[model samples]
Target: MNTPVSALMPVGWGILLGLLAQSASAGFIDNSSATLTARNFYLDRDYKGESPYPAAREWAQGFILKASSGFTEGTVGFGLDATGLLGLKLDSSPDRTATQLLSYNPVTREARDEYSELGITFKAKVSKSKLSIGTQFPSLPVITASPARLLPQSFRGAYLISDEWDGVTIHVGRMDRVNLRDSTDYGPIGLASPNGRFRPGATSERFDFYGGEYRPATNLTLRLLRAELDDIYTQDFLGVLHLAPMGEGTFKSDIRVFNSREDGRAKAGSIDNLNVGGMFSYRWGAHSLGVGHMRQFGDSAFPYIAGGEPAVLSDGTMSADFVNPGERTWAVRYDYDFAGVGIPGLTGMMRYLHGDSIDLPALGGRDLKESSKDFELAYVIQSGPAKDLVFRVREAFYRNQQDAGSTFRSDNETRINIDYTLKIW
Candidate 1:
């Protein structure tokens, strides 16, 4: 039986008030803030293969409300945070369903008219450390939430972060359940997605991680972290980043690597993967150029929670991450800021990625190849009544030669997004 929070609040309200009476400092209500965001989204995907599925085209609108309260002043402080999300379907069909923008009935294959969810988290701070218990959106080298779609995924658990030391920060967390971006219910954590992945249907009750970042200098940062999905897999990561200033621009070098294997009972079976990737970029005033590479160098594919971004990978796109076993990917990218041309809030990006030598016995052995070409343009209102409004579009053309072993089909996709935010404080 699920009990309402109101019924339990009274049990602790007195103690909360008693603590507030300490009165060393009081910023709770004074530092509270709230914001509401409105998003209009449209996605179109078509297949260019001999597959039996139809094209997926969908349009939807979403609203997200986030509220946070400041801590009660003292040697130790407490606060509360909440997030609410609502997605309304405007266009969809039985054949065009499964776009991930809306939930559909399994039997009917019809998308729902709408879906919504709300979550709450309690937080406390002591000195330079903070503890949060409940809903969370974590972004770390090992794992992170994805907001690339209509809504972002959220987790339920506890996390502690500390920066008490001068040059290092620490993080430890345990997440037991997650609400997928397209679903309204929380479920066990798993390592797979609707496409391009591994260990489908394998799930665990807990996902845990610890470790942090160290900044030895103003221009360099290093990270060492560990994560595990209980009874499934264990993963360790090493990351280094450095920025150097050149004549009129700056050059950035980033490297990330992950070594993973089976853990505990190994429910996902003989899991073994060494995921490695990096990116080097140079920026000069209005233009930036970059090259990236990511590879899966183990017996199996890289593991990550379903519906989450493979943030550690340098060349993951809407279609593929080039994360299959023994696969290697290389990418080139270019970005331009229209502000240099008198359009202050406009920007554009173009990138291409290719992967080969994929080893998947389920399809074929090695020598498989997949490639993606992507283009994006975005603009934000800089002033007037709509200062924060944003407009963006993304396009991708993906093809696979080892085809079935990688991306299921050669395809094209286009996405358009318009967003606005309003402060409710």
Candidate 2:
């Protein structure tokens, strides 16, 4: 396959890749591997309050093929990677659409019967540093891909990583387009807003970021990052993760902070936000207990990419982000590993979150509050024919006390996924 961005990328980078490719050796193909994962996913959502669409339920099958080639044997090596995805709808209707399992069918006001996507990445490595161009899957505090539905989100960009520094890693990227989890085409990036969609004319063609992670000790990690969505907003993030021994158990602490402001022309309109949150958990044998808290302070809500996953805070759950102007959230959770009870490969989790003090002056705000209850159970086959097969069930009960006239409604959501992977060499 040809490199999709070979002609669009800068000449200097192209020269480097050309040189590396010319030196290709046996390692380029010897260490290659491919895997295909088959996923059966179903989602059901029931609206709680007054709404035209009462429910949205859909089921689909997805196929994802990931193939990667090893770098050539040299100080400067080259490689390529590709991901192919296909989604087939099994059950859907026009009345009960918008389940995010497939693309929208405007003609029938229903979900499409099928959709597909392809992504390619060209890479070159020099010593311990590597640079990738074309498609990216970033999981960072500033920008991340959302994989909540039948297929995962994707972005077109260039990413670089360097790990030559002792105990430190550096990340830099320039993303230009985004494909939402439910979409098949990549397009301009937009800012996520308080009301669940991007404002009119609020879009950017590029996203730039630089970040680094440091590990000063075996049990501690620190990360700092700065990112900008051109003409829209700029955001900064700092996070700390630590682990300690606590009375026969281990205590884990996670703290994250985000500061955002309008950038350039401020297409998102005068962004100002500070999002602070953390999740702390203690584990003993097979039981884990955790507590989390997140709060948004400033004139505007938290800043994030539309349809992107910002998992920096514990409140970023299946149904709600708990991110609004003056919103503060508190959560508690419990988890158990069934292995302690003789059922290896099984796990369960329960969590509850309460959010209040929302500021929505436009809707009279009116003591705005929201709450969510979540449960998850997962199991994986340990041995036998289904060795690596996985089964997962997730449910969320969410409600908000928004204004009566508001279209936002309380929701009951359920998701089930069964997955199996096959290896091909």
User: lDDT of each prediction vs. the true structure?
Assistant: 0.82, 0.84
Instruction: Give the distance in Å from residue 51's predicted Cα in candidate 1 to where it truly belongs.
Output: 2.0
Which residue pairs collide in model 1, if any? none
lDDT tens digits by residue: candidate 1, 73-170: 87878877889999999999988777788888878879899999998877778999998777789988787877877888888877889999988999
TM-score of each predicted structure versus truth = 0.93, 0.94
The TM-score leader among the candidates is: 2
- Superposition TM-score, candidate 1 onto the true structure: 0.93
lDDT of 2 by residue, 9-115 (tens): 67435644664656456778787899999999999889887777788888999998999988877777878889999999999888888777888876787777789
Supply the TM-score for candidate 2.
0.94
RMSD of 1: 3.7
- Look at candidate 1 and tell me the lDDT of residue 412: 97
Error of 1 at 198 (Å): 4.3
Residue pairs whose backbone atoms clash in candidate 2: none
- Residue 281 accuracy (lDDT) in model 2: 97
